[model samples]
Target chain A: MRAVLDEVRFLAFDVFGTVVDWRSSIARAAEPFLTGHGIEVDPLVFADEWRSRYQPSMEAVRTGVRPWVPLERLNRESLETVLARHGVDFGAVTGDELAELNRAWTRLDPWPDSVVGLTRLQRRFPIGPLSNGSIAGMLALARFGGLPWNVILGAEIAHNYKPMPQTYLRSVEAVGLRPDQVAMVAAHNADLRAARAVGLRTVFVARPLEFGPGQTADLTAEDDWDLVTGSITEVADLLGC
Target chain B: MRAVLDEVRFLAFDVFGTVVDWRSSIARAAEPFLTGHGIEVDPLVFADEWRSRYQPSMEAVRTGVRPWVPLERLNRESLETVLARHGVDFGAVTGDELAELNRAWTRLDPWPDSVVGLTRLQRRFPIGPLSNGSIAGMLALARFGGLPWNVILGAEIAHNYKPMPQTYLRSVEAVGLRPDQVAMVAAHNADLRAARAVGLRTVFVARPLEFGPGQTADLTAEDDWDLVTGSITEVADLLGC
Candidate 1:
């Protein structure tokens, strides 16, 4: 805690798996929609499949194989593909329905410690979500989860996704803080590595359930982060907040 | 009030005068700095002069007289000009000092009713500050004033100044709402008029002391805004929230 309090000023959090239980949220929300259409599918498998499309979709945009598209659009496209692969054809989904489905990302349930931990951290430092989601997405998620962020920041502001230096830098810029003054908090080693490479501090909070029961990776810290905490609340306590 | 409620799904607010009392906040903060330097100037006049530079600086960008510069840079440039005009040149003032002075915009005091009013409004509609300030500026102000904005939309995002249709439209787009579904709530008549011209709903909240005791303008509604009230709290009550 003293170590973190000594160096970190602003705490920038990765929104998806780090702060919110995205897999469960999506699975829960999609279950009703899928079941309502008389489709039989394993909700967890569906959640994992949906999340599996995320990296490839982002890679497509980054590699210029696809034009720059928002995460909502990518989610919808990938959702359709996943549903089709499962031998379930809901005919065609309307744009409005697609939009509502895409918003499942915004309605994610926060990990139990997220709200209380972030609220504690917010008392001492500027806190914001640094995610690949759009500003609108982060804002909605924050409102839904009561994730007391001082600001919403994401790829939409930078027009670049994470592991990209610009995404982290844009969050720092938005908070009017120097890169060194901001700390990136995430459960993923790659995110912390990227943040550290750009001179920002990093905190590792283990999210063992991020990928669910069969998760094999990101269960332990892979790099030397500024601080290691079991939960966001632990991070807040360590930071003396 | 009913008319505004019927069409408005989002409420965009003007920050400086509508949401926060910049004149008082700036004057209060600047007084200590000025006094420490043995520079006794009319703090109110100095604050007004500082604010008086805002629109023109933005106009310089809007009219293509200057390239798009962040609000911080614009404020710094205007501060130098204003200081020079006041004949109080502090040759020893460092860049850091000027930077701090520029950030006075971010620490403005909110009206007593702002937090409660905005929180109430946020229950039903997306609420944010749509100002000529930068995203960082708005975020910092929100933190300092405890303004409960769901999002921060500023000229930095729009790349344009108020009274321009793009400013209003960009804010609406950022919130994923149609123009008519958004309401521009401002103390300034010109802002509401511009927003209304772009097919947005409008609300006029009169800030009688915005310009201090001798000021004559913005004491009453100039246009037939969808809603008019003496305070933002009143406006919130009228909205039935």
Candidate 2:
């Protein structure tokens, strides 16, 4: 067992790229939608554009420009904007169809090591996702990907999005553990930095392909996190699971 | 699959009696403490009294007489009150010891059919506990009993107790489903009634021995629930899981 994890009672994860291959999954789901609409756009570019809207939308909540709505609503608004910007005709889509497509965030496929690693880690400590994704969205994603999170926590419960102090603080408190007793395992260095700033131990896992072949942002850790690994399974091994 | 369940995407459960045998579990844990303190009270009776305080304490939150606090704190306060009434000397116990004893709720054993039944049900629909237990308390109990809940909801999320409209409403909403799309499966008629009143469908499972040999309350369904069964396993069967 690593001495660092000796006091850790819970291992909280960042869901999007850390647990699920969001880019690829989103691209795959959007391809048929784009092709059926006769849009001459690469599905990967569409996925990138849709995901780029995530931060600005969440920023509206963090900055109090919007009230706390579940990420599902924000996701839909962002999706609609992206579709219109990309010249895709969503006029053919019913509200129900648009809503179903907005749930693409909940239909992600997990990175290969996520499920097995999380299962191993769960045997020794409570494991859960601390995503900016709404509790409902995470639950749907878990059901879809077989992610074994012990409890759902984060934005939905905190009423605040990620990189905000409340999101990390509230999640740790929800798990009934102090910040020092819970480790935040995330693929993004900025996320790890935010978590560490609030006294949580941070583990950095690399997902070079998280943003696809032309990925630029978060290509590698910007700082030395408490534990840096190539895969979540390595995280399990380090935790002595 | 039952046609009635065609729209239902989730089944939220009541944890204490409906999922775990809390009465027996509490009694078993308290017996040693009572015996060590030279108390003459029947442990089962003590368990009943402790459980009886549950609602009133929760009512304080529901009625806003008390600010939102986790059930674990309420449980400890209730335990101390019961201990004093029975003349159990706390002078012999340490603060740490009392806190440890307070977690008896987290150490509960599931009813024999709970794990198997929930496992089966989970294959078809997402299942979770919608208990007034604090999120931390429920998570610990789930780990202990090997209960498989897809998400954690209820009191911790709603910051309100059972029979309170928000508790049921928020749970259904938290599952990312409309009230009509999530069925509340419980052992108590009152719980089901509360759930149904909030537009959630209901399932009542009989647990005649929940309070041990002298159990009287909830011996049979008091109201017509959407589905009534004898065990959690039967609930799975009826749901075609």
Candidate 3:
């Protein structure tokens, strides 16, 4: 396993639910907006509701149902849809106000193990996010969370989201590695499956609470992944970093 | 100047000869090879000879004489050509050794003012290289130099070289900014002129010693730039970071 793993030179992460606790971060960031708008609802549920729309929105662009748009724009549209569904007042929210509210995705908090794991991993290999987030979105999140990414890769560069072959293939080339030299690190199985189909190594890190305490999806390794670990720090350990 | 620069959300640097003292760094990296092989060529001249071919090589790709190749591959090819012209024996150098030596660009030392200036500027905006260097090349240089870039941008993503319209246009979009919202910071007047032609604000941070103490080009701003400064630190100060 060590010999096989030694071939990997770049580790691209799935940012949102993988490196950062997006649910809590979104809930935390949205709390003020909810209060300002005089809406009464559980922030965590609101966060889940907003996140539930994430993939479908990206799918629209991926399938050509919509044009290529930055994740920030998609996030805003999703947020607006969620706000409307929740019957939240939109009368007082100005463009700037809504823009600030939309930045909830940018201010996400990194998982406790993220910094140390990534730092250790980066010492041996370049580590960065291969996320659905916009380049600006990833930049803001890195700045906010103090993520030590050597580079940012994913959506904006490929103009497509993952599970798509374009994103996977372009990511490998972007990092100056062939498909075999890169690994996709994620808490999601579907992402790993797609990356594996494109010839990338895969490491699945379990995040049972990614969607909140009651979360059940991606709770464990779903296949014989390259390396399945309980945390990213364990991933560092397994990678011999 | 302050008011105009204050609106810029990202600062994209030209890496070679701008942030790093490339001539010295490359010369230094080549010395052991020169000695070990009993070659007596001046390492500095070798560095110049290698760099002299830089644009012509890119021009081939840009003009479709060659397929899109990463800057690293171009560097190695240029190095091989220079080595052959200098009558250096390469039969003794293994493939791995040549590859390792090609990474000289990745280990360049930052100029005296580079880190301080970039660090200060990063406090106010996202900063990264918008160089012709490959993504892996930039990542290695950033890790070696402790550059605090929020992202890597440039030729690799654009699939075009600088002074080309695609590189400048794509760099802005990669950073999720409009043309006017991003600033192109470089030492070369031609670089700034190209950037400005595409509506990006330009700042010339003169590095007269970039080619060596006897450097003749870009010693002063060739035209009225958006801002002209003696050092990157001065650029940061003028930007009010």
Listed models, DockQ each: 0.58, 0.77, 0.62
Better structure of 1 and 2 per lDDT: 2
Q: Quick one: ranking by lDDT, best first?
A: 2, 3, 1
> Candidate 2 or 3, higher lDDT?
2
lDDT of 2 at B200: 91
Q: How do the residues B1-241 of candidate 1 rate in per-residue lDDT, one tens digit apiece?
A: 5854586777889988998999999998788777766666888888999889888888888887887777888888899898878677668677777788878988998999999899888887778888988878887788788887777886866887887888888778776678989888999999899999999888999999999998899889997889989888998898888
For every model in order, the TM-score on chain A comes to 0.94, 0.97, 0.97
Candidate number with greatest DockQ: 2
Error of 1 at A44 (Å): 1.0
How do the residues B137-190 of candidate 3 rate in per-residue lDDT, one tens digit apiece? 898898889787889999987888998988999989877789889899999999
How high is the CA lDDT of each candidate model? 0.84, 0.89, 0.88
Clashes by residue pair, model 3 = none
Query: What is the TM-score of each candidate's chain B when compared with the real chain B?
Result: 0.96, 0.97, 0.97
Query: Each candidate: RMSD to true structure?
Result: 2.0, 1.5, 3.0
| Backbone clashes (count) for model 3 | 0
Instruction: Say which prediction, candidate 1 or candidate 2, comes out ahead on DockQ.
Output: 2
- lDDT tens digits by residue: candidate 1, A69-182: 667778888988887887765665566666677789889999999999998999888788888887778877887888777767767777778878888887788777788888
User: What docking grade applies to model 1?
Assistant: medium
